[model samples]
Target chain A: MSVENLAISFGSNQVLKSVNLELHAGETLGVIGPNGAGKTVMLNIMTGILKPDGGRLVFLGRDILKEGVVERVRMGLGRTFQIPRSFRNMTAYENSLVGAVFGSGLTERAAGARARDILDMIGLSGKKLEPAGKLGLLDRKRLEIGVALATGPRALLLDEAAGGLTESEVAEILGIVRKVKESGVGVIWIEHVLQTMLHGTDRVMLLAEGRDVICGRPRDVMSSREVEEAYLGAGVGARTRRKRA
Target chain B: MGARTSGIRQIGGAPGPRGGWAARKPLVLAAAVVVLALLPLYASDYGISVGILIFLYMSLGQMWNLLAGYSGLVSLGQQAFVGIGGYTLAMVTQAYHMSIALSFFIAAGVSLAFALVISFPIFKMSGVYFTVGTWIVSEALLVFFRNWAFVKYDAGYNITVAYRISMPALYLGALAVGLGATALVYFILRSRMGLALMAIRDDESAAEARGVRLYRTKLACFLISSVYTGITGVVLYLNITYVKPGAAFGIDWTVCMVFIVVIGGLGTIEGPVIGAVIYVILRQYTYNFPGISMIMLGVAAVAIIMLAPEGIMGAVHGRFGFRLFSTERRPPPGTGPRQYPEDAADV
Candidate 1:
């Protein structure tokens, strides 16, 4: 599932206005923005977690907004929140089990088996039975991705999965994202970590004030002047600061 | 026991609390059920009636646990449904002369339909609004039942029965209902729906952000709890053969459910079972005293909430990190990728 020409708002605050983007099979698109700039909102709109005030969301050329989040998940559209979401008291294995059993239509025993496999993929196989709340930030993020992956998604939307991680942790997360891409899952990753996102993503989009400032190749978009003024925080934005000199 | 011994015993046994609650609990519950199962057969008629009341409260507690505990609905007005169920049973059995056993199903269906309609409005509210809205709605129900003409308002209604049901029969009936209620809560918590409910409890908005259908999930839980509780009300009326507006619509029903789950473990599968047992015994023993029983209960509940905020099951969890029924993952010692194999697991 993918999005095109989407628009959304929260109350009077316009979160996203006429945003255009697409994600194909096994490709990655990076959405970069500062805090509260509506990166998450755009992802939410795309995944049908939130409804748009205007515009079209076509998943497989069918209108996706007509369906609910759980149905969309069943149709292979999965999302991860910026803060990891799990059943706190449940084992990490059980948290993923919800995705497998209900979202994937697997039986109870099958869901348990599937949860263990997902735990392994995210490098959390040994801790399948640990309560999710007790996990540290890094493991929590991994479980979030594992939950999305556990549903056997064709498209995975991640909201800041690598935030608050050290350099090595960031590299490991990048490896997981790449591995996901390699497995033929369409990926849309929203992150503030420009360096890592640049390294992991094939295409980069600059998001500012709910709309994309620029969208194209990682190098081309990052070097664009409008992107620098809004995001990328590249020398174009810094050059404006130097112009004050 | 020291913390280290608990640690060693846990590892030497199961790796975690996975099979812990499963093994010994049902055996203990079976023993308790056996005792309760036999009490009414040996005791006098009034004793059997008291046994029925125990079943009533136990079933209510189990139903409440599904909504307030497992689903995190935190309702305090289950009494509303109790009145609805009782009055509906009385109306059916008195006017229509429906079979007493079938009245239970009738009352449940009516109350569940009403609950679904009620959920349409209440499900939109969150936090305090949700809690207070239910209380007010229940109070409205109390007023309506009090003034309703056919049911005799505050005075109550009388039902017609073909014969005086035997003491052993009532006891067995209540026991059956209580056990069924507990098992239903257990199996549901052990399934897919249970995970979604606990997710609502942990962080509702985050759950929504991750594709959980907040309103539908909550509404489903509300209807299920209300229907089972409605059945409990009908059972209470069956044993007593009468129900007054104040008695049927009072806060006692909610109090019993809350007391049981709060003391037992709130969200754990075994929490309500343990809580129901403790509550029944405490009520039975304390009723022997005059006024002090209420004070004792109030003090104990307050003290437990303060000293053990997690309740009985939570305390167990704090000490051993055991989850009786959950599938969330915790990271082990290092960054060794401790996730479950999303494909298969012994869990």
Candidate 2:
């Protein structure tokens, strides 16, 4: 999947400007930026949740800007929200079953089996029958990822998959990310957890003020002056440096 | 493995040996059906008329519940389809020489077509806007029908002698439609489409992201619910032997539907049945009390809402863990404890 020359604005405040990126199979691209960097907006546009004012989004060699969210999901693009928006009244298993049945076009029996498998993969099988609204934050995040996985996407966009997670929970998520990458499905993970980005991703892209600052090897990007300057400009560099120290 | 076993037990385990209330539901429903079928033989004329009214409201309440409670499309203009159904039957049976029984099907078809046409515009609005849009549509239809020259300019239409069905047949027909609608809703809530609707109800954007075709699903629901409501309207007017534009399209129909569903249970299948029974009984007791009936009805509705916001069935289900109908899935038999790999948290 590739997005080129994408531009979007809410009134006069431009949120995304000429953003260009490409995600290829079997690669984990970690997107790191300070808050309000338009990371979520980029993911939304790619997933057909929002339309860009000016751009081309091509998935498997077809322009999909006009496709609706459901159609785009059926075409092998899947996403998880930052806040983990599972169906509150439904059990975790039912939540994933929806993704399997509708998004992946599986039969009911097959979808049921798939939902169980996903819950197991995410380490939430014990809570499969629990209503999503009652689950803790860690379980909610895991179910969110599991729902996206149930869609059988060729590429996945994870928006802040590690947000608000404990250290151990983040580690568990990174392990799942690695397993997903090994399965040859591309992933674009937006995260604020620098350590996870540095350790879990094949490449890292830094964005600031709605534009790509740099894109390279994770280690190289981390050490680059442009990356540090961007972070520092947004009041994130000192905190990150202190955390690293 | 130990944790897994305990977790399953904590979550109420599998369907037990007694299998909860859901297991006994079929037997109970069958007995009720038998009793209802034999009612005309033993019941007085007043009892049969009451039964017909109960069936009509029950069907209407169920359709509205499907639209508003399950699909989260809270329309206040269901009377639009109800009006269309009544008028279509009146026109076909009286003017077009169609048989009364055949007119029921024709009225349902007409209402379905009308719902499909109106749904395109109405669905563009979301939440409360959709509710208002439906009310406007019904009001517009009421005005049009009242002014239309062919229907005799507000003199209204009546079922002529040539197409009049017997009273018992009308009551039985209403009962059949009511039972059919209840069964249809029950089966739907247990199906894949029903799960999709519940998902949409919880969160539309999330459901859409999960590949539920939002517009198409809502439209299908609107049409289906409209068809059932339209059929109920035909049975209703046929019983009264007359159909006027004002009464057929009145907001009172919508109000009663809202009251029954809200007072019974918003999303449960049995809620409408319970609510309709209670509503019809309450109305019967108070109908001769002059202005006191409407006030009594309003007081009863407020009491239900204030005391049990989830509605009567929801309260019962909450307190007793009894579900006559359920969409929840049971665990696969003999499922063992879930295991996470040893290094799962190591990154």
User: Each candidate's chain A: what TM-score?
Assistant: 0.92, 0.93
| Best by the lDDT measure | 2
**How high is the lDDT of residue B5 in model 1?**
92
Per-residue C-alpha lDDT of model 1 across residues A131-162, encoded as one tens digit per residue: 78899888999999988887768788998999
Q: Write the per-residue lDDT of candidate 2 for residues B74-179, one digit (tens) a residue.
A: 9999998888888877888888877777877888889888998898899899999999999999999999988999887688887674245666787788899888
Q: Which tens-of-lDDT digit does each residue in A17-112 have in candidate 2?
A: 878788898899999877888999999999887889999999999999999888899888989999999998789999988988898888778677
Give residue B250's lDDT in candidate 1 (0 to 100).
90
Q: Candidate 1 at residue A16, lDDT? A: 83
RMSD of each: 5.4, 4.5
True contacts kept of each: 0.29, 0.46
Global local distance difference test of model 1: 0.77
Deviation (Å) of A64 in candidate 2: 2.1
TM-score per candidate? 0.84, 0.90
Runs of candidate 2 exceeding 4 Å displacement: A234-245, B1-22, B160-168, B330-347
Q: Which residue pairs does candidate 2 place in steric collision? A: none
